[model samples]
Target: MNWKDIPGLDGVESPGLLIDADAVQQNIDRMIEIVGGPDHVDRLFPHVKTHKIPEITRMQVDAGITKFKAATLSEAQMAATAGAREVLIAHQLVGPKVDRLATLIDDFPNTQFAVLVDDPHAADAINQKCGDAENPLDAYIDIDCGMHRTGILLGNPSDALRAHLDSLSGLRYAGLHVYDGHLHDPDLQVRTEKVKEILGKVARHEQQHPSPRVIVGGSPTFGIWAAETSWHCSPGTTLLWDFGYGNAHPDLPMTVAAALISRVISKPGEGKICIDLGHKSISAEMPLEKRFQFPDLPDAQPIGQSEEHLVLQTPNAASLHVGDIVIAIPRHICPTVALHSHATVVRGGRVTGERWRVTARDR
Candidate 1:
């Protein structure tokens, strides 16, 4: 679709992922400013999996942000190649993936790389692979602060494990990696309390070791660490705010940066309209209301969704027909961004005739 040709957004076409460049830049600036100032941009090890685009990473690098966090080897390689001084593979690598990670470090000797480790066996695999490459790997202790998804439990004798890893060859202790993925309470006070309680646990763990560079926060609880000079905050989604957090945390000093520009396709029935936006177009993990927000059609409700069809029922259904375009703010912008191969760039209320590729997708 020729997005630039359309004078009005209604003609931009269906299932189009439109990204606001101005808003993204604003977000980048605010993020840097929040965690101290532009001078302290290096303190943020931003997770790049949210918007898997090289353009975004380069924007950050150009603005003097050095450190980055990634979920997969592909993202780590992308960040390193994009001129990041340090890249942290926030997710653990095991078996053959360990060597691939080691090779990434070998491939880009200029860029320092580290991975998170919760298990000694996984650490052994990574260290052995790095040993084969005549290099010692840096590793962070993944401490579970509440999110049981990954990382070692805080009470699992993590200090002993930390001691054991320090003795192992071909590996250096980077720091403690604490991700409170579960601390996203809508109430700022509640979130703040939860953050302090969990971060206190992280602090105690650090006291035992004395100096493990603590990396914490996800988009929600970043404010807790924003003023904290010692803590390296890793807030990825804050770079591109979504409705999921935005709707909940109205007090979070950030704007809705990314959006999905989808056009209406068919009127399935009375008061029901079917848009081309399927579950594939945006993130379907959250509930209906939390998945997407429609500013144009306030009453628009996602009644059903499939691969290529999004059935909606709204009070203003009669106002929209086939080919009428609408803007949707995804509740979860991360997966929605990953859904598109490229984002149609818009600036000053006009298409810039450029596309930002979603580089490290599904890897």
Candidate 2:
């Protein structure tokens, strides 16, 4: 359906988000094809954190996705409620919210739940809680490949800690969770080599333990991940597509499916055009100036941005005026999406429909 076919495009407000459903579907199909063929459905577990909306998750499920990778308990719950049979909490579940994890485990009885643990203390807590339950909880050893953010070091895959957890009757050793956050590096060659090296270490660890039911890998390293390294690939941004990934591989099947639609709120000076979207609406973490592919206006540059404003400078800024709507593709999709509540699904230059409740907003 085209954007003009939607019910509320004319009267709807600006400084909002627009999602191209057609583009999104194409992306899903492309990624599925890349991982293997239709028969390899279990091999692709799209991360739900990218497009937190359940409707989108359902779409992915209908497309033969049984497994999902979520960053939080909320995301896991959302995916479960939306019909995801298997869900992986790609991060550690700690703190007083342990009850929440238990509640989810009780609620989604048929669903398989697994959480990543890099420390023995965290694993003990999870094991203690699950020990009392009838069904055991699945746990993965998150390895710190290169991104020193969450996982255990390569040399110390926390084997001793994993063994400790194995001794507990409540927790089952699922597999490895290796995410190369650094692989999205600007240099394609460097990123590819790093991913290969990291996955090689994971391969070695897997050989030693040989019994993990699931081997998972996150990040948009689809082009780099060896076909045999991972049993399932969890790529979030690859589904939605974004300016950051677009910059590195222009020909990638995924398009900028979502864009921050804003109107020219002000024209401060010659060659300077300001919009109403800023850090609050669009993500300032990646910065649009460093990322955006403006085929329509090649010379336009994001000079500065604030909480609710975007300053753009260009030689042809004189052509722009107030009330003119401008669609700014975000540098990063995850955080940029969190800033808005809903997204207008568009196609062929018109609003075809609307997707409400960008769901995974809660901390």
Candidate 3:
């Protein structure tokens, strides 16, 4: 559907988030096409963390997506209730959340649930919680790819842990979960090579134990994953391309679905422009390159940020006046989306409708 068809574009309040429905749908279509168009063999479990809105998730479901990759138990439950048949909790379910985990399993009987774990203690906890049940919980051993954030270290010794989990009756080994956030690095060749290396290791592991399926891939690496002859890819960011990926792969069909629609709150002195959205809205974690594809407008750089303000410096500061809405694309889509509660659907420079509650925001 086009943006003009949406309900409240022209009247949307300034400093709110706007999601281009056309762009978002295109992002979903492009990612599905890149991943072999959602046949049973090839699964596209979008990480709900990128766009937590259940409406967006429903948009994907309407397009024939049944599985989802969630970052937390709450997201999984939300997705399941929204008609997502399979939910993979990409993060480890540990700490004191055993009751929460059990609650999810009991609540979503029709839904297939899985979680990732790098520690035996976590596996033991999950196994203990779901062990005697008629249905066992699926568990994927997260392997540490190039990024050291999560996952078990890849290679020889990790196989022992997998074997131990295999002995547990309450837990069924699902597969390997590898998130290549490090591959989102600007260097194209470096990212490609890293993904290839990680996938190769995963393939070798699969050759040894073929029961649990191998799932790998993230938003930035989705295109690179399309050419893979083996392994499954879980791509989330493609659903909502941000400034960082847009700068890297401009040719990709996905558009900036979520933009911080901020008005020029302040324009003090030469070459400086301030907006109402700051670290609280758009994330400052991802760095921006000085160069940009958009013409006329100077490279927007985040010089400083506070709770409710983004301090940016641009060359054409004189061209921008206070009260003009500047659509600022975020560097990273996940955290940036988590900061906002609703996104206005816009088309042709006007707000069309409102999509409330990006469902997967919390936990």
Candidate 4:
């Protein structure tokens, strides 16, 4: 089935997110299969940052995925409300976020929410705000394996930081949070070796002080981390596969579950057409040509884009007319999903009249 085609797409609006419900379920099942099987679902803590909708979170919970990783307090709340057994706010908390997290914990008693801390002072701040909560707040020490983005170096210094966390009176030292998002080598062997090297350092640190639970990997190195039976895996973009990860890692055979629904607005010139999918509709982080892919018009070249319009030069533009539906798969689905408040659901080649709200799009 060409999951991109929507049989009853006329009812759907342009410049909005279109989600294939069946494809999303297929992706969920495939993720469970990749991490072993239903019995091994515990090893999968898929990140909820990709699709912030609570309905998708509920689908994962129904698939036996208990834990989830989130990037914001709102996302954590959405997961907890969606019946997630545990939710980890991967970002460190400061200022009003600390208190907001405390409230979230209090509100969601059934869900155990955790946060990341890379410094001792930050740990103290978290404790001060959440120490007296009904449930003991779970905290993970963010360790930098290789990506110098936002973690403490993995060595004696990380050991010392863990010691400081363990000493905190209110916070429970959950484990280590190592996110190697920067590692995305196309060669599986090369990527696997680099992951093993990072884990080797982690294993050495565990020799003296072992972490109770270790969460590692993003969508790029999810397969590598899944092999390590002891650690948990967190892969976000795999839920809604995009051109960015799909093109880079061909080994991961996940389905593209979401696409941008656009319509041709005009025939500007010879072999040139305009669409409403500007930077606002799709994620513009990648290069102009790399931002989106037209499955039907494979040769469509994005010549120009602005806040409200995207001009493309396609050989088939002469055959196309205004109001023709055009579907595009975004290079980065995560941020594109955030641009819309809701997404129209498509199943069995037709619109299901169901819209999943991007409930956690705000900060």
| Tens-digit lDDT track of model 2 for 1-363 | 333234456555778877877788888888787777688767887788888888788888999988988888888988998899999888888886666888888889878888888888888888777545457788888877777888887554567767877887888888777777766666757766777777676677667766565454555576566364546677788778887778776545676677766778999999999988778887766645764444455788888888888888888789988977666677788887888888777755566655567877775
Residue-wise lDDT of candidate 4 within 147-206, one digit each (tens)?
888999877777788788777777888999999988999999999999999988888877
Ranking by lDDT: 4, 1, 2, 3
Task: Give me the candidate number with maximum lDDT.
Answer: 4
Stretches off by above 4 angstroms in model 2 are: 1-10, 155-157, 185-189, 226-230, 250-252, 291-295, 347-349
Off by over 4 Å in 4: none
Error of 2 at 233 (Å): 1.0
RMSD of each: 2.7, 2.7, 3.3, 1.3
Name every residue pair that clashes in candidate 2. Answer: 3-350, 3-351, 3-352, 4-350
RMSD to the native, candidate 1?
A: 2.7
Error of 4 at 97 (Å): 0.5
Clashes of 2: 4
Query: How displaced is residue 321 in candidate 3, in Å?
Result: 4.1
Reference-based lDDT, residue 350, model 4: 84
lDDT, candidates in the order shown = 0.81, 0.75, 0.73, 0.89
Comparing 1 and 3 by TM-score, which wins?
1
Q: Rank the candidates by TM-score, best first.
A: 4, 1, 2, 3
**159-250, model 3: which lDDT tens digit per residue?**
77788788888887787787787766667677778878877777776676664577777777877776674456687778777767878766
Give the runs in model 1 whose Cα sits over 4 Å from its true position.
1-13, 132-134
